[model samples]
Target: MLRRISFYVVIILFFLGGCSDEHGTSPTSFEYEALPAPGNFEITSGSYSLTLSWDYSPENIALAKEFFVYVVDPYQYGGNIYPVDTLTVAEYNTSKGCTFDKLAANMEFCFVVSAVDLSGIEGRRAEAECGTTSAP
Candidate 1:
């Protein structure tokens, strides 16, 4: 009986020793700083498309790896926003804007642009710009 009790006590001590309140260090414990949002966001309507343009400071351009464009069809989904496209910093700098094509004619849409850093952290969205495509 004494030997069995000793074995049980050893098992209990082993289990208790494995449990601890302190948590191990996490692999992704570093904080991420978000990039700044793009400025001067504007949209121009086309036959069945919309062109979006925005400005970012040279300092911000150096930090951002890409830009994310989001769109909202307020008439159809009651202002439900969704990501539409992503443009590399080089692409944006070359064209100075992004074009969203193949849209419904004469329909109104809203757009916003955000900057994304190398770490894939997205910044706040710019002020929304709304426009209507030309009738086909």
Candidate 2:
């Protein structure tokens, strides 16, 4: 009878242990860090605007909560980068492009996209992509 009780106690303890967070790590034990940069950045021209496209970082898509799009207008400060938009994976169109409209026609613009994680961390941005909006 004692041996049976011991076996049941061991089984109960084992089940409780497995119920805890992964591998004995507490739920709050994990640390959040900035995600990696995006990849395959591309830009296209539109009438009085530009379109931006990029691939999620090789391993970052799973961790990324959203994406930030930045624009640098040469006409703004001879070139000054500014936050222009935010996008989610679901918003991508058939062409995989996010179009920024109402831009100054015939001007050059630069774009970069960064992944933002759940912890509100902004990751490194993809390489800058430059293009000129079609003349209006």
lDDT of each: 0.88, 0.78
> Candidate 2 has which clashing residue pairs, if any?
none
Q: Candidate 2 regions off by >4 Å?
A: 1-33, 57-59, 73-80, 93-95
lDDT tens string, model 2, 28-125?
A: 76565778777778888989978787776436666767788887766775567789788875564234558888988888888878888877888887
Worst 10 residues of 1 by lDDT: 72-81
The parts of candidate 1 lying over 4 Å away from their true place are 1-32, 73-78
Q: Flag clash pairs in model 1.
A: none
Candidate 1: tens digits of C-alpha lDDT, residues 53-78: 99999888999999988887676645
Clashes of each: 0, 0
Index of the highest-TM-score prediction:
1
For model 2, where is the 10-residue window of minimal lDDT?
Answer: 88-97
Top candidate, metric lDDT: 1
